[model samples]
Target: MAANILTDPGLMPELRRVDHGFFGPDSVAWRVWTHPSILIGLQRAVAVQFLNPFFTAAHDDAQAIYKYPGHFYDMTLGFLLSGILGDSRTALQTSDFIMRIHTRATGIEPISGRRYHANNPETQLFTHIDGWQSMLKCYEVFGPGPLSPADDHRFWNECATAAELFTCKPDDIPRSRDGVREYYATLRPQLCVTEAALSGMRQLLATSGPNSTAKLAAFSRFATPATLITLPSWMRRLIGFDQPAAVDRAYLPFMRGLLGTLNKSKRATRTTVRLAAPISGRILRQHWAAGTPRRAEVATVAEARKLYRQELRDENGFSSDTEYTAAH
Candidate 1:
């Protein structure tokens, strides 16, 4: 997401390894989720979650969720980026961090007459399925997808396997494309726009905050409209988003142009996870030592920068004598 970490020094680990985690360099989920166009897929997933009544209600009441909504979105994106491309150890650490966060997201639901927790298996299942569908769906629409029917099936199956790596239930995983379609169909009756969902969606799409730089802010603006336009028409209607005929007519060409831009540079999209280890291990151990008494250590920006560069060289696969010769 931040300028081809696949090739960046000081930020990327050895990422061509095949055994890093669940979906390796060879897996379709990795291929699908790591691409630049995954931006659209992730945006789709964020928009779709509000249709869940319980999630909508909980999110509406949680002020922390709104105060920095864009940051919240970016944090999730970072988690996914670091997890998916990171080696086995890094992936595990990020997963643990996310799970710990989810455990705290519990609340009572007035409508369903049940308690809602972000880490609840059922809720996790819902989010996973929606997220999975949105990623694959948008890839097919906006990226180099619409895979051969065989690869398409493999994509969905690989995603199921990826899901199992997290907190997914074996019984709830959709192991095939048809299973995903059937699952969504079954949930259709339950999907509706609550006042909370509507309000959140509005704000979510309205603007990027002041903290975003101009370039990031512009992309943030394009992201909402493009993602909304890219979602299935039935979904747009289901969630009470309207697509005027004129907007639809204009958006298709714009999407085609945008997708063309993505297509033009395949090198930028190539990202991989290392087979043998985690990329973030050193960063976590040295700087973010969660349990260490030395956590209070702080430094000026210049010291921090020097320390980071040294750490990157030391832990990210290079000797002190080899910095100039090593190619990312």
Candidate 2:
């Protein structure tokens, strides 16, 4: 078995860098995210995230998802992994890019007759927590064994730290598994199914987005079912992703085998990254070229964020931090 290009710096020289960014190698985030199976989790979250009508509407209006599903998926995953694995500078730049994207994704939501903004704390928090939940859920069931109780708690706690990359404050993110469930339960009643949401979900599940090759579509036959089974039946039904229990039973082993191979085989991981590179986001591509820090220097989210701010200030010739913030 070869090493994963994303994790082993020996393969991805760019991964070799000094700063560990927000989460260190020992953190639960790095532990789970480095696994190949988390890619499934990310795909699953792409569908699940649209369960929010506002999010779906915003995405639909932006013409990012339905119009360009494969691009949307790859770009989202690219930015996400960059934030997790890139050094402090890359992560902060990725976050700023996301913020700009969110800023422009604002409009009247057709269903509720209310305006929707992607950066709204409620929306951002939902996306942030749901993504973490999806990643960890898939990682446990298929990638690696489940975390211990303490580690499980730490995963959720660390999720808050990761949330700093987005608009959400740490306090807004759930610190426990139960807190996540409670947050979802509270948000469930407000979630409504819309045609845009269903259409976007179908596009994602089919992998039939613009510029998606036939090979990718063929792979989606196996990958989509695996992605669907990761979601709970209720949520699946809510978003019209209905995979039978028998399908789940039949595909579970294959999914596990496929992901396990990717986790272990360097050639497989490298191939996957190469396939995804065409649609990768700018920050992720830049990070790949520039590489991360070589030394494992850990920094708190706040401290790392200040570095980003300082760099931004220097680049733009902002006279003060306040001016930098305002300009941004």
**What digit string (tens of lDDT, one per residue) describes model 1 on residues 40-95?**
66667878888888777667767443676545565555556555544444444444
lDDT of 2 by residue, 38-100 (tens): 667777887888888888888788776656555666667767777787777656665665665
RMSD of each: 12.8, 5.4
Off-target runs (Cα >4 Å) in candidate 1 are 1-19, 208-217, 266-328
Question: How far in Å is the alpha carbon of 133 misplaced in model 1?
Answer: 1.1
The stretch of ten residues in a row with the least summed lDDT in candidate 1 is 271-280
- Global fold similarity of model 2 (TM-score): 0.85
Off by over 4 Å in 2: 1-18, 276-295, 313-328
TM-score of each: 0.72, 0.85
